[model samples]
Target: MALSLDTIGPDTKNTAKGRLEPAMPPENRLEMPTQSLGRWSASQERKPVVDRSRWRTYLARLFVFGGGLILTGYGTYEMYQVVSVSRTTVLQWLLVALFTVNFSWIAVAFTSALLGFFALLSQSRGRGPLPTTLSCRTAIVMPVYNEQTSRTYAALEAIHESVEATGLGAHFDYFILSDTTDPEAWIAEERAFLALRQRLGPQARFFYRHREKNHHRKAGNIADFVMRWGGHYEHMLVLDADSLMTGECIVRLAAAMEADPDAGIIQSLPLIINRNTLFARLQQFAARVTGPVIAMGLSVWMGRDGNYWGHNAIIRTRAFADQAGLPDLKGRPPFGGHILSHDFVEAALLRRAGWDVYMLADLDGSYEESPPSLIDLSARDRRWCQGNLQHMRVIGAKGLKLPTRQHFATGIMSYLASPFWLFQLIVGIALVLQTTYIRPEYFARDFRLYPIWPRFDPERALALFALTMGILLAPKIFGTLLMLLRGHERRASGGGIRVVLSSLIEIILSALLAPILMLIQSGSVFQILLGRDTGWQPQRRDDGSIPLRDIVRRHRWHTVLGLLSGISAFMIATSLFLWMSPTILGLLLAIPLSWLSGQLGAGLALKRLGLLRTPEEFRPPAIAIRANELQQRNATFGYDDQDGLLSLYCDPELRERHVEMLSPTSRRKRGEIETDRALAEAKLGDAETIEDVLAWLKPKERIAILKDPALLTRLVGLKSGTSAIKAAE
Candidate 1:
């Protein structure tokens, strides 16, 4: 596909004075052909071969995975002893198996944290210096779905300013690759694009393109750009809608790519920022405090075979176009279609093709936002769960390395662990119920010397529980200790005492929230396993407040289950009730806990008292502040406030720009009809006024009308009332 630079109007003689047409940057074409999953050339030559067998990588992997296995073995034996006071029943054996799986999961984390803690102490946590210049051009692209145009565009503007400040701005081009399906959002983006370009002037290399068909979602959006314009640049820095990075970081990343000819993708660790709601703040704190340790550990072991997290990463354009074309999995829906989690697969494919994929653990200035509420988080998690679960198919694709496969396995287990934990809990409860209520088989049919008793070694079980908790908390502990030891970090986070208090608060809150999330994820896993698909949806990105009735309605079942389980545990034994207290408490308070998750007041009150205060919150980054200011300024312009039809109806120049930017529609075949288009045409023909069309048109019909030039021309000719489409109902 050869995309041409679109210059809207060559003749501006009749134009209003001082008015300028929105001109897009000339397209630098590239061809990105899709690659096959089942076929690849093993003998293909590359500049640099990634040495997975390097001693450091080998030793790191050995320490992490090998240590996890050794710990799992010891933990399994202790669990067996706790359960096997006598002849082990099926339930006891199953419990031990579950224990082994769950134990190994944390054991890996514990081992990784140990390695990361030492690595951090020894290594400097900084990219040496920003490069003064770069010889190669890079495209900084952000793919937007049905997101708020103000926020997304504002972020781009801020990044643009930051990049220009580095004096390397000429080497970078910015593209807003929009996959927006929303009619209003589509126009709003165009309006913002024009206004933003005008503000930045003609010399700024900013462009916008909206896909007619949002095929394959985000991956397709990016692939479309790569196929059309990727060849212009040596590398592409992909950013999420919520992603923000400093000029130094962007320049450094491009320089790093220039320095390493074999580097395919270098992912940066993005810390969460600008969150005010309690759940978002909790996440922000946790990611700031402990996320680095975990990320550093993954970097140590992953080495050149690291994973891409979809955004905040720079990819070599040629390598991605050649090797990372994702193949659709066979079958249907969640598992059979286009890959949802394309980043990990892309990284693996690049590695399979002998390109080095890396994670720059020390890289900073990359940042992103978290979902503001539990419900919002769960909604996002559902899509992620389905995506990760889909990896089960691709893990076996030809030519993937063992570590790449391990990455796949780890992703799969991340979601699967929830179900495993839930099942283990249920089985543990069942064991207790049997012991308390069901009669035990005393004498065997063979006439055993003594009667068998259904019992666990209380002391050993308690010790095992302690060990499990220790392992689970090790990463957080290490993170806290590191913060306290570093004077700058300690002072930034409100001193050692406040840091300790905040960590404690985070630990307690996370403990309370874990059970709820476990149940949510477990349900998602079951749904995906049953062949259910989680469709794409735009995440809510503001203060995620919910109505009282909605909160109760959502969490009532959880509360009831918690109550029943608590009652049963108490009825079974005091020890059992005590053991299950955390889970029970979390589930029982699900409604209020969920409400608190979105409460800005609670989060702010804590902020005032210096609890959950991240270093970023104390010293706000200039880029973040500028983005927020631009967002507010953009909001005031009412670009996002107007409906698509009304915006076009009101502004003739915008309508012209919109029509010019639309990709030429293909000719329909004989007997072919677009359902939405047909419906939209019929409605447009019947409509007497713009008000009538706005009142009667469905969302799909609106989109269809917006896309059809003829229909939009008719919509433009409609009689209007004194007022346009109202922003409020």
Candidate 2:
């Protein structure tokens, strides 16, 4: 597993004329391993065997799932009995069906949480010792889109330093895989990378590669890395731009992968961190307290048939390449083309090939950031909604394990349940309107003991409602109690009283926010159904406060709808109005709610009051602290505001590095016009100075000029007062 530093060096060479030349062919210049490296050894192959332990796991899952189904059935029957006590009409039956579907969703979550709670209670708190040495070469890959260059490289540097501290640095290599589209971002990434390498010294095993075309976005970025350089490593630990992991966690994952030859992927549960906005902090706290129990429960039942979250996980590189080559779905965008949610599908494919996918839920020090605002979260969720819905096409694919299919179903339901709940609410309102305004059938074709009345048994309905609320709230109660019982966690989360109070505040806020999310998700589902695609967009990770006007513009419709609904409900019945108050209030206050969600002052106030405090917040981890420090240090002028053309014109070293990083352009067919290059060349010929060319060309045109060798050479010469026409020729 010893890594050789001989092959790792700067890719720039100086020619006799002092012009920079690419040291290697463009295909091999981006720090990729040579193609002569062998694939994973045969001994690493996973063998499928019928282990009796799988049966036990299945039985446990069956028991938990079966119990949930049974409970849901009884609840549905009780509701049906109450509805029938008045009158069983078509509308009533539809209400019953909607109620059953929506209730079942919660029922499954309740059961899963119940199992997770018990699992947490039974498990030992102590982490097992890590192996002193590792025998496999692992690559830590962080895939970046148009993300902040400083933050990404800073996080990587922190992780590298942490791993080196563990005294096993040579066995692992770090990669920053960039698929950035913006020319400014591309340049920024290269600058940051070179700086990071220099800071870490030449012996440090850090490499970077930028792709010309994004292809399938994040999934494609990783795939390109695998196809080109995956052969050199036994394992690859994939990470997102916002991901940060401790050295100990990284080492343990690698050691665990080496120890278990049959395992294909081992996922670590990543908690949210570095959040200051009220909404972000709330999400962070919930993930800290409730995420582990839920994750552990899934792990307990999933055993060998587990899921991958795409990042913060270690995987058997060969198994992934062999089994998880993603296919373009049948047709175009949205549900077709490239798979958006590739992680789940990859996990399923690995399991189909008999490779075990596991979740190490107990592993700590894995962290990620949340969206800074509710609006930002909605944007991210829209993409996720489309991705999850796209799973409908893959769920029935042949050879998938039953548990894998279940995982797919669970993901699909996560988005679908929002719309289902919205539909149920609409149906209930319609039924109430019909009962109040429309005439009910006094008699039916069938014989009846008495005339049918479209009225529900209030007492029975109240009891059923109470039961549903209890089940829905049980998980939070369980999580709270568990945290209280654990002395370390309890103290870390302020006192028990503060924890309970924070939980209560969180619950109230969640209740207020739930309806807003439901409406937003419903709209997203409708949009997706109508063939509107959500393209890949970078998430907003920093907690800068959102403008009030922007919040109002986004939520104006919600407020109007809330007013109308409240008026209608009150006109129908006082009981209906009272029942719908929570929803109405949330909707009516949507703008303010969203505005406050992104407010830093409010979040800080809560922090100062010792509310919503997580263990990480109270005592920050070393890796997190180091990452923050590096981020502050690495902050520089934003790429977008600076002139891309002038940047290269000013710095000779940067210009050379930029040229070395550009992928060699493909040869054009005869008579095929390079429109961008043609326009860029024309602009360069007309310009007298760098400022003239910068003013004449747009962002895309400028990027084109930089990418083309001839165009860039001409632009550089013109900046030095040379003849642009001769340089172009």
Best by lDDT: 1
Cα lDDT tens digits, model 1, 425-538, are: 999998998888888777778688866556799999999999999999999999999889898888889999999999999999999999999999999999988999999999
Residue 352: error of model 1 in Å? 0.4
Quote each prediction's TM-score.
Answer: 0.95, 0.92
Best by TM-score: 1
The residue-by-residue lDDT of candidate 2 on 404-509, one tens digit each, is 9999999998998988988888888887888788875657678776666677888988999888898888788888889999988899999899999999988899
List lDDT for all candidates, in order: 0.86, 0.81
TM-score of 1: 0.95
Candidate 1 regions off by >4 Å? 1-26, 45-53, 666-672, 723-729
* Residue pairs with clashing backbones, model 1: none
How many clashes in candidate 2?
Answer: 0
